[model samples]
Target chain A: MNKTIINRLLVNRNNNHLFKRTYSSVGNKIPRDPKYAVINSKDIDYFRSILKDPNQILTDKDDVDPFNCDWMKKFKGNSQLVVKPKTTEQVSKILSYCNEKKIAVVPQGGNTGLVGGSVPVHDEIILSLANMSKVESFDPITGVVTVQAGCILENIENYLVPLGYTVPIDLGAKGSCQIGGNASTNAGGIRLLRYGSLHGSILGVEAVLADGTVLDCLSTLRKDNTGYDLKQLFIGSEGTLGVITKLSFITPPKPTSVNVALFSCHSFDRVQQVLIRAKKQLGDILSAFEFMDRPCIDLVLKHQAGTREPFDDSTPFYVLMETSGFNEVHDGEKLSSFLESIMGDELIVDGSVATDSKNMTSFWKLRETITESLGKEGATYKYDLSLPIDQFYQLVAVMREKLDGKALVYGFGHVGDGNLHLNISTPNQSYSKDMLDMIEPFVYEYTSKHRGSISAEHGIGAMKSQHLHFSKSDPAIHLMKSIKHAMDPNNILNPYKVLPQ
Target chain B: MKIFVPVKRVIDYAAKIRVRPDKSGVDTNGVRMSTNPFDEIAIEEAVRLKEKGIAKEVVAITMGPKASEEVLRSSLAIGADQGVIVNTDKPLNPLSVAKLLQKLAETEKPNLIIMGKQAIDDDCNQTAQMLAGLLKWPQATFASKIEISESKDSVKVTREIDGGLETLSMKLPAIISCDLRLNEPRYAKLANIMKAKKVQLTTKTPEDLGVQLNENLKIVSVEEPAKRSGGSKVTTVDDIVASLKKHSLI
Candidate 1:
């Protein structure tokens, strides 16, 4: 439980064999038939000789804390030992030896993740692959990039941008999220509306099984109807199956032009009307359509002062619209005329479009600041749901009406993907319980009634596990449990997480 | 003397895991994966050992699908000499993996083997012990410190214990499971990254090792851990004492 207890459990081994002198900082106290045996002196030199570079490896506790847990403050454990293996053979030997000794191993990538799936829930060893990030190969012709999983999403974008290719899927956490974790999580971000998902883009995956067996499914071929699509399992298996080391994804061609429009809506109805009208005219060019509630818009304006609103008039809702096309002049003109037509129909009261790149980013800030803005408001409760676009709004409206006096409610969504983000807030701290007990279930029931998903893009981490039943069926749950049992029989891989207790 | 260390890629040690409410296994969607931190330290130990001239070569090995090889390549960046991957899509247990590595050991014969004490994904601390049992070699679990003899035929290791550290002497070909306190792991320098690409890596299959991997261990269920409900805060220590007395604890 304490550091001393763990340290005492790992006494040193002294060997006089092969002409070795041993010295201890403490007195000449030798260890007994310790619970953990010390390796012979010769083995130390043997391991040292095999390493390509040992200077960079860290073994101290100070070096391990940063690597221990993830972004979500949920799963925690004591693995008094941490190791970084740089080669596949070293990983094999480590596994082989650990297998011989009955030690456990945990693989890690970019530690930025929501699920407690990455950290240890027990005193298991950890393996960090942060150093393994690199672009192994890239072929523009095939529109594929083979890279190590540890590579960050931002780095991948930078690497590919120069080659006129872009990783279609991106999120706010792109700067910190690693490609390996992205593949493992099957992450869906803002760009998912425009570019599908990893199930389509990720061509192959290379991962290590629980026992250190490297399964190489890193196929570059786009259409390989093999006996079984094993890569899909690990794509979102959360490392229960194995550690993903490399990924081969189909990078899409870069868009020639991008445009954005921010519109003020008197109500959610007008927002929907504008969406229907814009989609009809803009059609395939409409890449993103995001909605923001009044409270969220107020928070953004308050927090990020001087970020201009498109209109001087006040509105209860706002919509951030974006479109990407191959032709700049033609697409820009079409987008302008379409917005003008919608404004004439009273679907949009007031709005402004980004004329340049700087303005385009400024418009995006209005949308990206939702998470931060919600943080500014006290005690924020989040609900990310997916339902029929029309029903999604109705659910939020119903929750708002139900909680009119109980608490403050805000509702918005990514209309393009039918994902809704509803937040409940209270002026008083006491309302939090009322909000959770009374409001949370009501919102979930509404989503379920509409045949909606409890989780859309953000995964069902510890925060949303309790509501998983709202989205999944009994047979589906049964199959998932069977897979978990088959892969991790000892129930050690991220114990107490992912599966319902 | 060369050393080969095995590191399994697993969930990032920090990500929060959520068990599905509907009795499904953990919701893996958006769960992050990384190198098991303990294995990283093991790799650091090997790299330090080799840099200190205690050993000659360090090869990193991982047994999984192609994605697992990324961790091996990461080891290359961390200063591993090269790598050998036993590629398999089928999930295997500690015993089976040990069998495959035992076959590879017959050819490589690494002087020392090191790994993280356990993986973060499935915290089963069995692979190293099973490997040692299969190979009939002295096993050191949770080694905090390791000192090699000059001739490299023996090793002095410090094992973590419940009360204090215990030291032992063992002959050559020993398995040492690394603890967090072993050594500080290093990052791959920009210069070494290019070199890592040229590093030789031999990819093998279960067929190559002649080890048939049919999983033996079976899981009956994958349940989520109990959630810690939000508790009311106590105003002061005296109020806490009153609550304790009310509960008849002290």
Candidate 2:
């Protein structure tokens, strides 16, 4: 439960290989494997020869810093070389050499993950997917797009706009996050409740294994229930097993008529009631049901530019409900009736509906840009958790109680999908060991007590791998470890990740 | 009032058009194409008029190759009562297009012809005026706002100009060209597109219409704009400030 015991236990972690690096942002040495070759100048020459572009090899201190850090700047890696491979064959060659030399590699996508998954934990060579972004194949009729792993999510969405299709996954990081990274992390955004998880939506994956072996399970058909769904294993693996090079998936047709309503609820219970009413009344039209506390709205309105309070008055909690239907007038009437009933039943206090396209976009900003606004305020100890609909607020309340007013605690997330992004705004603008010590294990333990997932949407990157046991059973994790070792026997794919040390 | 909207197919604004190696013109091969953005605004305005019950019917027309039907179909998808394509292989200048539109105007006899002030591909703001002249009808060009008179006899259009705003009242059968500020076009739904596909699109050859199109102006050659290289990024704000001070610009 404490640092000494935790560090001592981590010291005895039975990793196949172990090496300790000198520096880390978290003040803990990554249990890097010693069997993995320390990256040397010779490796850079070999990687440069295989990648073919000297510019693809980033070794400059400034150029390498961005790849070495996570999106939140919470974790930093000291890796000297970052190799970008444009083709799968290039990745094959690089990995083959790295496997032969026992050099560790961290496959990086957009590097926009909230967790520290994309960056190297130690002196591992970084294999970036930026150069591999291309639309390999597109079937406009079927709405299935086959894209190289590094295509930015926004680019894909824009590319499919003319075809009347849209990428199912939508997140705040869509502008920067790659489709491969989203698949790698199984990133759940606001649309997950509507389009379903990427596990079902993603059709196939083509990846390069640890030892230069190509795993091409890239199928584009909607229904291929042949044998074990091998692609599901790589969906949330966080790049520990292989480097995702290409993906072929079906994109859902873009919803024609989308309407958003921002409403203030009296409490979490009232929010749940409104959610139930929306699902029952709006039915198929209800796409997103997101809620945030009063503090979150206030912070967003204050810090985020051009964003105003959705309602005239404030309530304890707020919900942003979106509905999509073919007929605008019909869908508008349905949303209006739902809103009237929720307001009439006193489940919601104040509400505003987006009557026009302009208002709809403005209303979405109040909920979509919360993460950026949170960062502007102070240090954020962010946790993305999955709990039962009724039990979501309990963890937030517990965290607030434990912090005891030392931090500004708030929760907001896709409540329709039972995912809560619990955040703690540290009084200091930076994290302290004391604050984390109080927050961790306790949050994980509470989530475990409630049979909730410790890392929902975001995968078990380096940050939460130690506590993954809280969510997965021993046997299940044992199987996971076996799969990890089998796929990457030398532990060279992405060492010190996913599977616990 | 009956509205006739002439939309054109052009390379989508989002597309970065590349010039062919021969330098004859822009390489349209494998490039994304869409209805000219300004014409899209005109279509939106016409659709709004029909939705508001100010206009009885919305008819869309285009003249070009078979590929031009796509724009007409897009117009129908957004909200057009009927679509007509004047099939012709010859490159039509603004004058030739105006002459062809005049023939259509004489036959269809729409009360008002709503169109874009200028197609983005050419940026030639001539078709509306030429058509108005050819039909001997009043015209309101560069219209940012259009208000159909309840009497159904005329339209008061608010036009944007360098000096200020110009308000003009034009009689029925006038050509009203739209500007950018008319309205924002909505994303046509899948259902509407499917319905649009089912919507009747009439195709008539230029010979059948007895309308001849000829290119009066020739585009000599086209070249792509120079590619801009990335500027050096300052590592920090302090570095930016120091660099600016070093250059004596601070």
Candidate 3:
């Protein structure tokens, strides 16, 4: 049998088992947990008293609807009230009152999450951290910065970049995502290959527990081995553990020179080879290694305005690589040699290097615009997965064949960290439950079988709660539940998320 | 027409200033250095003029040690066409700097010389005026806005005066000292910073420029200003009056 045909047959055979298994009762109308108390006039009065500003207390339906819906618009709740707290004390008071009253509260930062984590699934009171956007303090010598959780990521970057420093994380939704929210979801972006994840970069985090006790663990020291590292819990708790009010993280010095190059690879194997060679050759200066398939770029060009195709002849894959360092001449020489060797070895067929910032920005746009373009294609089933680098593109090919003529399956992401963003959309741009059924369990099962993560950077909010077992073991799930119970006994902090009921 | 922009490398504004143990000067060891903020504004203004097609080229000049070339590179990154470094490790007074710039201006013969009103380190605020006087050109100090005539023969400058605004129109070949409100300097993008490495940068010594350095002013001693003492809290008017009287500040 032909290799491609054999692979397709194997995928089909494996998917049959997935099809036989029943759906995990996801996408059904989730009933609001009745154990939690509903928001009433008395709760509103208490919120008004605590949040003195009239504008902070948003009770009007028009004012609260935006907070009620997730950014993807896939999940919408009937949240009746939204309270924006300006200080950590106010957050503590609100959470304490809600915990005592058994009134569920959903803590929202910029609300720019994909998994519907930041929005309420029921009539939970929305706690908006919009008013707490402030840079508390910054140490110029050590490059340690403390910012309120409500501070937008881009705003913090803007504030620090001028001072010869930069926030460690960079994401596609930087303009809207809050730093606190970034910490809560443990966002892994293009620069993760260079700066590592927030788990290591975030030095300390201040959070409010379910009962309104403020956990002040905002440490600025880089090395502290005292006792248990409790701040790590809030880093990726998805706001289920607590509400992160402020965070202190070390900012790396801004790179004096940045160089971007776009290359066309004929195969995923070649892409992986280029990544390995880049890591070996470029060494410390290597910042990002992002890859995308032909369909991903095509959709971006089709849907996104002001975006032109990077290459005249579209190939199997495209890679966007960036290098940042102190000396431009040295970094440029290293990059030139790397590019030459890769091209000489025929690992890349065609390539273009940006000589100016404008061109570099355009190169990054091709990779960053994938998510926004997928949304424009309508009814996208987005999956952020971390797989073995060798099998990264294999899953995309499998989904493409399985959903052939039924939908468009495109893959793109930060290949440097072995993470892939797989997006599937209908040709007619309409929602289909049958299409949903075909993709879910099979994708999860295939990922599990290959020892890949079901949710890589985007945490398991309400959307993937049922599928947590696919990635974690029963003991691990039980431990997580036990922790949730111990910390938030009333289940008031972001109820119906992260853990399976 | 050509625009000459003079930038200076200074201790970064964000870096903390610490006096040396010998009380000679502020410690610069391992501290970040950047283009003086006001000079960055001057560079931005010159680049804006070139972008508007009023100037054919922008030549940024800096006089200091070899490390000063970094600021010139930053100037080029912000869109200057060329950079000139007056190599001198020795500190120069305002008059000495004015003399060297006078020699360069005579040779370059630019239509306009725009520079910062004062370097933050020295705060002398006399170099631009001295250069204008030495070159015998009309001078506009503390310029908040500038406009050139359609024929490009003369220019108009809006000066930020102590109490109000002052507008002056002068012929070509003039000097204008930039104020804080002149323009906001743009960030030197990484690509442009790399491209700046290819731009023309000439290195010449003060002797090569046919100018001799002379520091008429001498510093006998340098001392940091006295630390402020904490003020005591007073709850009543009588208590405030008593404290003020005790200190003889009433």
CA displacement after TM-score superposition, residue B239 of candidate 2 (Å): 30
Which regions of candidate 2 deviate over 4 angstroms?
A1-24, B1-250
Residue B19 in model 1: shift from native, Å? 55
Ranking by DockQ: 2, 3, 1
lDDT of 2 by residue, A1-501 (tens): 001101110011121111122113443546766787887778787777787768889999899987987756666787988888889999999999988999889999988777788888988888999998898888988888999999988788778866768788888777778999999999998788888999988999999999998999999989988999888888989999888999998888766566667778778999999988988999988888998888888887886666665655668898888886666658857875776677667786766654333445656777777777776665678888999887999898888888889898989999999999998986335656677778888899999999999888888787887888999999999999999989888888777877778
Q: By DockQ thresholds, what CAPRI class is model 3?
A: incorrect
1 or 2: which has the higher DockQ? 2
lDDT of 3 by residue, B36-125 (tens): 878889999999989998899999999999988988987898899999999999988889989999999999899999999998877899
Error of 2 at B143 (Å): 20
Ten residues in sequence with the least summed lDDT for candidate 3 chain A: A5-14
Tens digits of per-residue lDDT for model 1, A148-195: 888888788878866878787776667677898888777886777778
Q: Among all windows of ten consecutive residues in candidate 3 chain B, which has the lowest summed lDDT? A: B185-194
Put down candidate 1 lDDT per residue, B185-218, tens digits, no spaces.
5534323443455677789999988888857777
TM-score of each: 0.57, 0.67, 0.67
Question: Which has the higher lDDT value, candidate number 1 or candidate number 3?
Answer: 3
Output the number of the lDDT-best candidate.
Answer: 3
Q: Against the unseen true structure, what C-alpha lDDT does each candidate score?
A: 0.70, 0.81, 0.84
Worst 10 residues of 1 chain B by lDDT: B186-195
Per-residue accuracy of model 3 over A1-501 as CA lDDT, tens digit each = 011100110001111111211222237646888888878899899999998989899989999988987765667778999999999999999999998999999999988788888988888889999999999999999899999999988789878866889878888787778999999999988779999999999998999999999999999999999999999999888998999999999999987667678888899999999999999999999999999999988987896666786655779899999888888669868986787688778898777765434345567778887777666556778899999987888999999889876888889998999999998876434555688889989999999999999999999887899899999999999999999999999999888888998
RMSD of each: 30.3, 12.5, 12.1
